[model samples]
Every structure is written in C-alpha cells, then in structure tokens.
Target: MLAYLADVFSALSELNHSLQGRELNIVTASEKLAAFKEKLVLWIKRVKRGNLVNFPCLEETVTENSTLPPTFVAKIVEHMQMLCTSFDGYFSCGELQTCNIWILNPFMQNLEDVDDDGSIKEDLIDMRHNCGIQMEFTNSQLDHFLASQREAYPALATKGLEVLVPFATTYLCEQGFSCLLHIKTKSRNRLNSEHDMRVALSTKTLRFDAIMEKKQQ
Candidate 1:
C-alpha cells in the first residue's frame, strides 16, 4: 500500500514542482488527487486479480475480499485532503476565472491579540473594503499595496502578508531531497565541485521566456 502511494506521488511530482512558491488555491489539486486515488484503487484491484502481488498474503488479502474497503487509500486521503481547500468562502485570492472577494475575511477573523492602534484598525478596514471591491487579489497587487502602507499599518501589513505566503507541496520537498541525494552521491563527492555545491537545487522548470532568452544568447 505504501509503495502504491509512492507511485501516485511520483506521477504528481511535476505538478507539485510547477506550483512551488506560487500563490495557490488548491481546489483543483484536491479534485485531481481524489481522482488519482480512485484510479490507483482500480489498478491495485487489477494487479491483485492478475497474480501480480509481491507477497502471498497480499494476494489473499486482495483476491479473497473483492469488496474490501480501500483502507490504505482512505488513510492517505484523510491527511492529504486536509491540506486542500473546498473554497469555504467567496474568494479565490486571484486564482479563479470569475474574480470574487472575501479572501481576507476568514484570515482576519482568525487573528488575535492585535495591538489597538486606531490607525492600524482604520487601515485594516480601508484595505479590506478597497481590496474586496477589486476584480481580483493578485500577489503583485498585494505586495505593492502593502509596501506603500507598511509604516501606516505595520502589524496589519505583517499579518496580511502572512495570509498570502506560499507553501511548497509535500511531493516537491520529497523530490528536492531526492535530487540533493543524487547530486551529492559519493562518486560526485570525490570530484570536489564546490562551485556546483553553491547552486540551489530544485525540480521546477525555468520560465519559457527566460529559457528562450538564454538560448538566443
């Protein structure tokens, strides 16, 4: 079961890499992940029925009980789906086709113990009102707006920035560590490549425009 999950995640590494460091709305990722899990269950059934089980007990477990619940899939999905969002509110944070507002409502409601400066509270109200009316809440717009008002709303701006902070998906981190291990293999260590060691390792592809420019040069 663990090995099957590894296969599923390996297939998803490219998607995880593509999304790293980008402001995300995980509604679609969650749907695709659920679909993939269903596909995996079907594959498992096919393999087991065909005598492809790696262990004898796996054959007994899968072949005997054709109607057995996919306990492994359920366990994995329980934790993974927790990290996903079902768009509980009216905002996409600039990640949707139809731009909507209310992205900051839930996050604001969650903040506690804020210092009571009348100015900061006023700024928060104004920012929320103004941004909520906009067609979208893009990361660049958020950055510029916050930068211009940092001194005016230090605490609010900090918290607002935190709300927009991006996180790497689990598969991306696993693939990165895998790459690091491969790059620093004992055979390569013998070559004393300090310059190479200084480069940050990543699995993401470069932007298409940047790659084209490099090729021209």
Candidate 2:
C-alpha cells in the first residue's frame, strides 16, 4: 500500500510538472491548475465518503484479525493515512503554481517563502489578465501523459491498474510462508526437500492459474 500511495503521489507530481510546461499565460495556467485541483479534491472527498460509511472501523478490524499480524495491518493503515494527507497537499494547485513561478522568475528582486499553506497571492494579482488563448491538448497528448505516469510502475505499465492485485497477493504470500515456517518448527519431522518442492510447485501452479484466468477475462 505504501508503494501504491508513493506511485500515486509521484504521478500527481509529474502531472503538475506537465501542466506547468504549457506555454499558456499565467492566468490561463492558473485556471487550468485550479480546475485540476478541484477534480482531485472531489475525488478524495468521494473516496472518504464511501470509506467512512462502508468501512468505518476497517483499520481496527484488520488490525485485530488473528490471521494477519498487527504489524502488517499497521503498515497498511499508515500508507492509507499518507495517501490522505498527501492528497491534501497536492490539491492546492495555486500553491503549486506559485512555487513554479519562484523558480522561473529568479530575477524578481524579492521573494517570500511560500510554504504549502501559503496563499497564491502572487498569481491572484493577474487573475483578470488574459495570457492569450491557451492551447488545448490533443487526444495523443493526453494519452502520452497518462502513459508516462503509468510507466513509473512496471506492473502498471504491463498489467494496468490491476497491478495492485498481484502486489498485495505477493505480500500475503510472504505472510503465508512465515506462518508455514512456524508450523514446521512445531512439527517433530525434519524439513523434507521433496515435500517442500511439491508444495511450492502447487502454490506456483495455483497462482499461475489465477493470473491466466484474470487475463482471459
């Protein structure tokens, strides 16, 4: 989950960079950035609303589940929290543009430290000015941005968004192996190479079958 959130935040940062690259005037760029931020905030709100009602105590329940260790559940919860907090930071498109302006206009005699929470006062001054008509993205251009974001994760590039399934499944497999080790230690019989080989092969076959079924669908 940490990896997933990292990927998402990284993608958003990349998207911001792309948006800043447009040759539009400051006012036009600011408007586009504001629109993007609004969309992101709406997405976050939708996620929170659904999660609050459907799984109000999901984290606590998962933590208490005996089949899975608390540490693993804690990690998941930590990642979820990171996602929530980071989204709030990223949703401030105006602040993001202000930071970009500081970098591009180094010749400006004075600059103030504009942290994430700072008002985008610099851009607001030119809010009514026309920066000329902004160019719109073609379908191909949009596709390129999406492709670049997904390329950050190889699984996402290959299997698309369903990449999370395999990632989570792999983690679960590690926990299963740990439990198997505990069980083996309790048994009197020593580790049998042949038996272990057969068990591993069966597990691999099952996983492969599942992957194939998903692909077929």
Candidate 3:
C-alpha cells in the first residue's frame, strides 16, 4: 500500500516542483495544472482496468506476491478519484483570451479575435509590422518584453503586464525564509539580518568583479 502511494505521490511531486521557482507565472502554472489533471484522469482509467504500467513499484510488489488484494486496489482507485475532484474544485481557467494569445505570440493573433476596443487592436497591428520590436519580443522574457512596450503600446502592454506580473507569492515567501536561514547562523546570533536579508531576497543580479574592483584591498 505504501509503495503504491509512493508512485502516486512521485508523479504529483514532479508536477509541484515544475510549478515552483522564482520565474513561474500563471501561464506556466495553468499549462502544468491542466496537463496533470488529464494524467490523473488517464491513470484512473488505467488502474481500473488492472494496468499497472503507471505504478512500477506497485506492479513489482504484486508480481512478488502473485497478486494484490482486491480491497487495496479499490482503495487506490477511490483515492485517485478524490484527488481529481479536489483539483477540479480548486483550479479553473480564468485568464482572458487576449492575454493567452498575446503571451503565445502577439504577431500571430488575429485582431478580430482580441477581446478589446479598437485601440488595442490598432497597437497590435502596429507591433506586428515593427520588425525591430518583433525581434526584441522573441528574444526577451514575457514580462520584460511587455514592460519595454509600455511606452509605445500602452494598452496592449498593460493587458499583458496584468497577466505576466504577480507571479506566485507563496514562492516569494518560501524563498525569503530560505534566504533568512542562510543568513542567520549560530556564530552570527547577535547580528542584525535586515540589510543582508534584503540583498539575499533581491532579484537584482550582483556583479562580483565590479564590486571587487571598487573595493580597497
């Protein structure tokens, strides 16, 4: 039973790890969540049919024992059903159509399909033809690319920013806690960690070579 659950949780753990990290946004989170739910549905069907390919450890144990008890197999199916119900209740597709299309590729989106006034559509048309900015959009991060467009394409960029900014706050809180642990040691028990904590939590990249060149030996 424990081995069977380990297989189930191993799949979930991989999904959880993929959704975490500093750079994660709703776009990536939504895609992963949708894929995981689909896998759960497929697993439920496979397990019901006695297909243990998805659960290697469970299969190995059953092979050694000649067969798994009927009661425990039923329990596993029930557990998977409960998980699918819980996930469906918690997550829903809430991002707007324009936001999704813009993130994928602004140039490719049809102006008619965009859910906006004429102004945003006009901005999109202009952006599609601007080869210079198009190159930058392809090269840069979604949030950064949208940010750079704010001056030239306020409406379009603002909509994208609304979707791209505000990534997982839970991730930020956990990151801050990890940084605190690294900075606060037994030897430095008396030290004030406010300044060091800021540096550790900051998203800015530090240039060690430039700092060393400026420092007096």
Candidate 4:
C-alpha cells in the first residue's frame, strides 16, 4: 500500500510537471486524474483486505490552481473529491467529520497534557486539515489503523505498525533536504557528488537514531 501511494504521488508529480507551460485541457488532466483515482481505489482495497476492515472514507479538496485553466483544474479537483468521498471513516478529519473507528482522536484529546504550550495541538490541527485536503489519512490514524490491522494480519501489518512513524519522519526529513537542494540548485544541478549525498544522509540517519535512543532512555 505504501508503494502504491508512492507510485500515485510520483504520477501526480509527473502530471504537475508535464502541465507546466502547456495549456491545461480537461481531457488530458482528466485522463491523468482518472489513473490516479484508479490507483487510489486499488490501494484502499488492498489496505482494507489486509486489515480486514471496511475501507475508510477519503476526501480531496484542491485549492484553485491559478496557473492552470480554471475549468481543467476544477474538473480534476471535482473528480478527486468524488474519489475521496467514496470511502468510509478511513481518512476524514477536522471539519470533514470524524471517523468513529479513529483511535488517535483519543490520543489527540490528551495532547493538552503533553503540550502545555499548545504548539503540538496547533500542529495536529494543521496536520488534520492537510490530511483532509489531500485525501490522505493522518499519521495518527494510519498508526492506529496499522496496529489494529496487525492483529488480523500479523505478517503483513507488523512492519508498518512498528515503523510507520519513524519511516514517515525519516521520509519527511529526506524530502526536506531534497527540496532544499532542488530550490538551491534549481533541480538542474547537484551540490554534492553521489558519495557525498550518501554520507550526509547516513550522518543524518545516525543522528536521528541517537536522538531517538536518548528519548527512549
């Protein structure tokens, strides 16, 4: 399912890049959108089957892309919204209605105890909002879902349940550096050689592991 999501995201990135400088057409965008939706449905089905639970609902809201034609972007957004709404209580968050099966909501309710300054609460709200807009599940929800799924499909769900947060955090940090390099180098250049990039990434990974170990202690 993770691989499927990655593939869909890659496709979306490709489509976004392809649409740049080209006049956006509904037909062309719709074709890409349809493929994306199909992949999403397949992903959901796989997740549902692996977990032995009913699929969670998904909702997508694309803010207007002014660079593209309004009609074209609107059509794509509408299609995404429909595809997202087709699921059950899987991914809904914030103003988009809560999922009854969400185990993370309880944890989130207790955030006040952990976050006396309220920054964590604010960050969670933002994360939930983004999840709604992107038609993707929250990390909390995903964690709980995978954990529960592990009970039903031990082999399939164990790795995800164990590593979801660490994996996601690592991915985000890597992507952040990737984005920084892209903008600084204009995506047409590389500041470091392949060996240097690997060394830097390895250093970051070791640092993260050490920090996590300290936290656990």
Quote the positional error of residue 138 for candidate 2 in Å. 17
Tens digit of per-residue lDDT, candidate 1, span 1-217:
6554554466567445555443442533444455544554555455444533433443455555464355654554553444234322322332422211222432253223333544445555566567543333443455455555568667656655554544424544665666667677887767644444334453465476887888994
User: Could you give the C-alpha RMSD of every candidate to the true structure, in order shown?
Assistant: 11.5, 19.0, 2.5, 19.4
Measured with C-alpha atoms, the lDDT of residue 53 in candidate 2 is 25
Q: lDDT of each structure?
A: 0.48, 0.42, 0.81, 0.43
Name the best candidate (by TM-score): 3
Model 4 earns a TM-score of: 0.21
TM-scores, all models, native as reference: 0.35, 0.24, 0.87, 0.21
Candidate 4 lDDT over 1-217, as tens digits, reads 3433354456567755653432333333444555555665665554433421222221122223423344643544454456566522332222211322122342244443433342334444454555442243444345555565454345434543433333311344555578557444656465555655565545344566777888994
Candidate 1: C-alpha lDDT = 0.48
Give the range where candidate 4 is weakest over 10 consecutive residues by summed lDDT: 52-61
lDDT of 3 by residue, 147-206 (tens): 998999887888888887876437788888888888888988888999999878778998
Model 4 CA deviation exceeding 4 Å by range:
1-11, 21-24, 51-83, 86-217
Ten consecutive residues with minimal summed lDDT in candidate 1?
Answer: 94-103
Once model 4 is optimally superposed onto the true structure by TM-score, how far is the C-alpha of residue 125 displaced, in angstroms? 59
